[model samples]
Target: MLDDTLKSQLKAYLEKVTQPFEIVASLDDGAKSQELHGLLTDIASLSDKISLNLYGQDSRRPSFALNRPDQDMGIVFAGIPMGHEFTSLVLALLQVGGHPPKVTDEVIEQIKGLDDALHFETYYSLSCQNCPDVVQALNLMAVLNPNVSHVAIDGALFQDEVEERQVMSVPSIYLNGQLFDQGRMSLEQILAKVDTGAARREAAKLNDKPSFDVLVVGGGPAGASAAIYAARKGIRTGVAAERFGGQVMDTMAIENFISVPHTEGPKMAAALEEHVKEYEVDIMNLQRAVKLVPATQPGGEHEVQLESGASLKSKTLILATGARWREMNVPGEADYRNKGVAYCPHCDGPLFKGKRVAVIGGGNSGVEAAIDLAGIVGRVTLIEFMDEMRADAVLQKKLKSLPNVDIILGARTTEVNGDGTRVNGLTFEERASGEIKRLDLEGIFVQIGLIPNTEWLRGSLVEMSERGEIITDAHGTTSVPGIFAAGDVTTVPYKQIIIAMGEGSKAALGAFDHLIRS
Candidate 1:
């Protein structure tokens, strides 16, 4: 629509303005470096449209600030925006442009009123894939409210620092000097913690540790449900965990969970914890169990040593150690995992809405994810190493029915292709055909399998399955007396949260049985 003269003038202006912009590249052309650089270069060359570019390449600090050049913003391209990163970029761009983005006014007021400074240092790995959002959120806090700063340290990049800080888990955040929140924390919850830290400490100091007849390990649905049912039975119980939510903490959103049509992982975890808190039980949060030893006598008591060096003696022990997602273990896969690689479709599916994605696996989880993603993403590529799907016929049919879903059978994933910042595509080879195909996708959801969190109990009192699942009796009793097992870590067929909770309740009752018999 513009005249030739005007178009030339605009081109000249763009050329002049882009001369001063700096391009920060982490890798050589080996990655999508050139493509990303070109994209960023083009975006940065836009007019003063207040485009906020929140850079997520900082491998240290839970979150940090990146100020644009004197020229007001152009286009906002968040490199690692999923997980906490997306939230952070949105908030950062808002603050840098001096215009608040689309959020409730009440939320804005709460953020503005915060005056005290709180810093959250979270140790996370790119492979975690769920940790980026938490980091992004903290970054947003740094922008919206001046009182808080978040720094995310890449667990792999900052191995020495993580070891020094004693951070063994992803999304392990320290508020100020003391540990504040770990795992996925909501903005409201984070604000409350910082606002009520002193008050909470003072109040907790006054309250005495509640006595319990049984001590349950883990606090996912299984542990939380167990605690609640035990309280209902008038039994004193205590639930301990490194992180209160357990494996479910990494979930983005849970749609398959019964009763609730849809629920976020953090919300579900908070609700469960709140329910247990209503009971008279000692809730030990942010504590890890180091070792479990048998009672000194025939059936006196079991001693649980904690990572904090604190010990808890209980008549009964419930091992609810759950399972952790397996990593791809391929090059560039770990580097760009959360950046583009993900494990749980339930947790990260919403972000990939309308985008091309590939689900890696042929089992029930993979087929379910492919079917689920077909509804959200533009295209769903289901890759299986076997000749056919390993999932139920119903799910396989559902997955195949989706027009956008593509099935690549007998294909094994060889490498996850990325541009160093986010996943661009994946490479796989057909076992029977021996033909290799590279898929270009915006995201990849890995549903290979889960590894049980029962390695620590190898030489101890419990037996584990060939798949690393803990063996438990009908009542949740383990091989050792006074010891019980529950949840996904147990040899149960189902790994649902509701099932875990039900088993946890059964384990609590079984522990009570043993305690009374003793």
Candidate 2:
């Protein structure tokens, strides 16, 4: 199941194992069972301390009982740990064998204080990169306390259970038979939900109306940068974001941030929040701005109303609401969102490496994705609705130079075809001949244009472009005297991380200048 190189690496990791651990694998008479059995056998052979036991599947099909003797650990895997979740398996084995959990003392205390029984059923897919983190965190939590038992379910293997639970996405977590969390979640976030009373208390404290000198909306790279800059000026800066990471959290590998050679989206997003936390910036996460009220006069304060019924007033305002990727909205697109049809090439492309994939859209992002995928994947098919490509000459040339890439023009994607579990292929119609065509591919990356998140500014004093993007001049000053805008939600020429960060800094300086003048 694993290559020689991987075996060698795993051997080194297993060599450090000090405590004894056994992997009890229970498999049924299924095709995937054989594959999983072989994988577990290979892993068990890597270390002397590790042992593998095979058993017939019971009510819990394809289950794994880790450390059979120490059943009190309450650690179990109800799915084959492969793909991105392989790391979770490796870490679990080590943790069960006496390796301490990576969680902080505060988190440990929170887990220890839990009196009620917490049973977590986390559904995940092998290809989902974000799923492993949540799975590992829950596994670690289970190891920390016997009351907290977790069953990591592979959504692919347990399709019936997935359908019964209406699990539309990966990392769908259920606590005590109720949906607990979804998508990428931090350990602290999970703990917050464990104690609902404490979570409500914390939310109430944050909901208390807070005022600031410079209030930045959205918590993407731009908003975080703006908050940092404003806070550095010794002002009461605050950031209101539905999620701190914004679109950046959806991104995968980022290479064009200037100094940094390579980093993932979640990593950079965490860094942004951590850097902002270094300052005195008041970060109000999970808070959405429903409406913006501009200052009546030059020296008056602008008010921002949140969906949580809380209000934030500031002398100067920075709008870095960011943008979201436009979806194709075709049949089966939403159903197989994380199953195979993905949007961010940077985040999910590597998962389809060496597999045949398709890229929809002829713009810069689509062309760039095709070029990027051509190197990693076996083949890339670029389909464009228009007759001619709309990408820049340089990017078009680079895309054309890829030998493993094929470009198709005047093709309208009809539907995303999947086989219940994941995407299998796609269908399209020729715009000229009306002939239907199909391509067998594992992944489809949609890199269409981004929709700016400036809809909330409608009817407000802020001037916007025809496309709903905020129109701002140099120094990030908008049409409004005290209000400023930046990032993808603005009419900025380029929507990039570094560019947005620079724009945020400029907007903060512009706010400082306006505060001094008035």
Candidate 3:
């Protein structure tokens, strides 16, 4: 299944294996099984430390386990780990073969100390950009802790399990036999959930941090840029974020970043974090900022409070909290979220295969989602609130050419209909005819847009727009002195990743200029 070039690359990577491991497969005589057999054969041929075996006794057919010859490590791939999961497979091999993982010693120790007999099964899609992180993290944990076992399953290939579990989303994790979490999660986040005392320990550590000269409140492109710029000035810089990468982590394809022709969200986010780490920035990921307290006296530090009960003070604070996916407030929308309502087409599109689904909104995201869904789903109904689609001409043309797609303009989504468990259909009002219509579908994909993450600033000293966006001047400085805002969280017109980064850098410069003047 791999080309000659890929073979050469795999051989180079496999040479780093310091110990011997076996790829034991229990594949039946199916198409995917044969394909997986070929992939394993190619991989095993590249490394003398690697050995391949078939016809194992695993209950899940077309699956394999990576383990030492003497022991079962309990790290299993229940489906063919290709596409986005190919990287997970490679990492599993390297780690199982005794190559050290690229994780902090502290985190590695935490994983080793876990004594719970936890078994994790994650349902994932091949096209999902968010699944690899969850799969690889669990794989590493299983490799580290003998009490932990993880099974990475491809949802599309295992339709029976997907349907039985009602998994409408990718990266749906189950602990033991119950649902644990859905969507993207970091290794730290997973550890926090499993390790009970991890949160209190993290909070205590965060609370002990000293005051920073320039403090950034987000970890998106803008926040990363700001942190880097501030740290370069030989100042103490710190970044506290709900999760590094912000909304950019949910993004699939980013083509218009200038010079970089193609990149995924996770890859770009990783690069941003790596760049910031090159400086003296102290990054605190998975930290949510809930309140902002302005400095009472001039030339004093402002305080930013986190949901974890940790507070950070800074001379100048840069707010780059960015935005989140806007949701329809209609009835049943919230109730059915992840039950049948989804946001990313690339992540959840596979579960809706051979079923009817609807895409809400007619902007670029909505149109692109419809076009992508048309290939996998049985039918796609695109509904828009405006009379005309806001998508570009090229996308509109492609969407119109798809035979399995239908577009409805001037329609407002009224209510989402579901049978208490999952979405069944939706009701919309036609603007032109004043007629209420219902779409009978299995899923609804919301692709309207984003809303700034500045609700915590309300009633505070910070000036805000009617849309709840933080108001900022040309310098990225907010209404309050010594408090600057940038990225989508501010009053910036465009919300592109590149624009956010530039604005972040500008905000850092503005903060520095203010510090010098003070």
Candidate 4:
């Protein structure tokens, strides 16, 4: 299963294992089971502390569990962890073998202190860029607490389970036989959900923090850049965000991030955070900003309030809050979201494999999603309200070459129709005529655009565009003297990662200039 170079790396990683463990696999007489056996054998060959047991009593075939020799607590992977989850496999091996996780010690202690037993099952797709994080986090939790157990299942490989559970999206998690969540979630986010008092504790901690010279709201590319620039000026810099990566974390392939030929969103987001950490920026993740109060006078402190009932004051405030996927807002769309209506084709495309699906929009994202889904789903229907596709000419040409794809222009999506549990089809209206049509499909992918994260700043003194995006001058300075805005949350012409970073840097400089003059 693993190549020669991969084997060398695995051997080196296994060398760090200080404890003995076993790979207990439950298999049947099938091709997939044979492949899994070969993989386990290859991994067991890397270190003397690791042993492989091919026979097990578990009913789930092609599944393996990693456990310590002295402990009954272990984590299970029901499907082969390849592609994006290969990192997860490596981390499980090391973590279950008594190696420390990359999370903070406080979080580690919190996981270990949990007394309630949790049986978690995660259904994920190999192509999903967001699945590895959730899977790995749960695996680490299982390693930390014996009361916590998790099984990571591949949705594509286990079609029966996916259908029985009505899973229409990747990274669907079930806890104690009930649906816990769907979509990407961090360790802290999961903990906050499970631990009832975590929010109050976090709020108390945040409330005790001192004021900062430059405080950045949001933690996307722009926020990271602004925080770094501010910290470099020997000013106290802090960053509060709902989650450090913003919408970029949900993005798939990013090809235009200069210098680097190609990269994924999660990888780039991690790199951005790491680069910012090289400075003196104090990052507070999982904190959502709900309100922003402008400074009373020049060089005075502005307050940013969080949803956790905590607020922080800053001398100069930089609002780099990014945007989110624009929803259709049609009837039943919200009710069926994650049940069948998904925004990320890269994450949820595999769930609709061998089934019909529709992509709503004519822009580059929509065309690209159709192109990617053509190879996975049985049929791809691209519905657009416009007369022509807004995608690049090259993308449109390539989309036209796909045999499984059907393009319908001048059609607007109307409603998402679903059976009680999952979506079955949707209705659309013809632009030229008053006729309404329906598409019999299992999934709908929305790729229209984004809505800025500036709704929280409504009625504030800051200038803003009609779209709710903060308006700023060339210096990235908002109408308010001590307040600046950048990134997708602002009225920037181009909403790209590089552009956001440049704007953030400019805003930091502008804030400093104002600070000195005041």
For all the candidates, what are their Cα RMSDs to the real structure?
12.8, 5.5, 0.8, 1.0
> Better model by TM-score, 1 or 2?
2
* C-alpha lDDT of residue 466 in model 4: 88
lDDT of each: 0.68, 0.84, 0.94, 0.92
Checking candidate 2 for backbone clashes, the offending pairs are 252-347
Instruction: Judging by TM-score against the true structure, name the best candidate.
Output: 3
**How do the candidates rank by lDDT, highest first?**
3, 4, 2, 1
- Model 1 C-alpha lDDT per residue in residues 1-518, reported as the tens digit of each score: 33456445544444333223332323233333344454444434454542424343544322233444554222222233334443343344445545444556866776677787666776664434456556655666665765666655555444566446644345667777676655556454565556555335433532344334788888887788777877777877888876677877776568887888997776677688778889887877655677888776766777776655566777778888788887768777877765668776754565565789999899988898898778877999999878988999999888878899889888889999987667888999889888888999888888888888876676775777888888888999888888888899889987888899889889888888887787
Query: Residue 255 in candidate 2 has what lDDT?
Result: 92
Write model 4 residue lDDT over 330-433, tens digit each, in one string: 98898999989999999999999889999999899999999999999999999998999999999999999999999999998889999877788999999899
Q: Write the per-residue lDDT of candidate 2 for residues 246-360, one digit (tens) a residue.
A: 9888776799999899987877887999999899888877777889998887688898877656678889999999999888888989988877787766545555657899999
Please provide TM-scores, in order, for all candidate models, with all chains considered together: 0.61, 0.74, 0.99, 0.99
* Candidate 1 off by > 4 Å: 1-146, 149-183, 186-212, 248-267, 346-356, 375-378, 392-395, 419-421, 433-437
Worst 10 residues of 1 by lDDT: 72-81
